[model samples]
Target: MEIGSSESQSECNLSIKLGMEFDSDEHAYDYYNEYASAIGFSIRKEYANKNNAQGM
Candidate 1:
């Protein structure tokens, strides 16, 4: 996904998908952090791992 300031919603949707299931958590966070930085926002670590599957 191409993340940019003008593409906040698309970026957010991609972040949601990444949170659900992407290549890896580290990668997801990297992308999310980059996006957040570009858009002047900050995300907590707790929120980053909220979508982790717990034996489901």
Candidate 2:
């Protein structure tokens, strides 16, 4: 998956300069959650349907 600044990157004041690869989506989510929590941020899970191109 690609990691880049969101449209409001400036508002967040955080930047990710590295790329990460995971064996599965669950793994990625866990890693992200841990990182966010460690850095005093919160995140939520949103499911995307493969059939829904618009979601992608």
Instruction: Provide the RMSD of all predictions against the true structure, rounded to 1 decimal.
Output: 8.0, 9.1
Q: Per-residue CA lDDT of candidate 1, range 8-48, in tens?
A: 55545444343266598888778778767656577767633
- Candidate 2 — what's its lDDT? 0.62
Kindly give the stretch of ten consecutive residues in candidate 1 with the minimal lDDT sum.
10-19
For all predicted structures, in order, the TM-scores are 0.43, 0.52
Candidates in order have lDDT scores of 0.60, 0.62
Provide the clashing-pair count of each candidate structure. 0, 0
Give lDDT tens digits, candidate 2, residues 1-56: 23433444345443444586779989877877766655556799986567565655
Over 4 Å off, model 2? 1-17, 49-56
lDDT of 1: 0.60
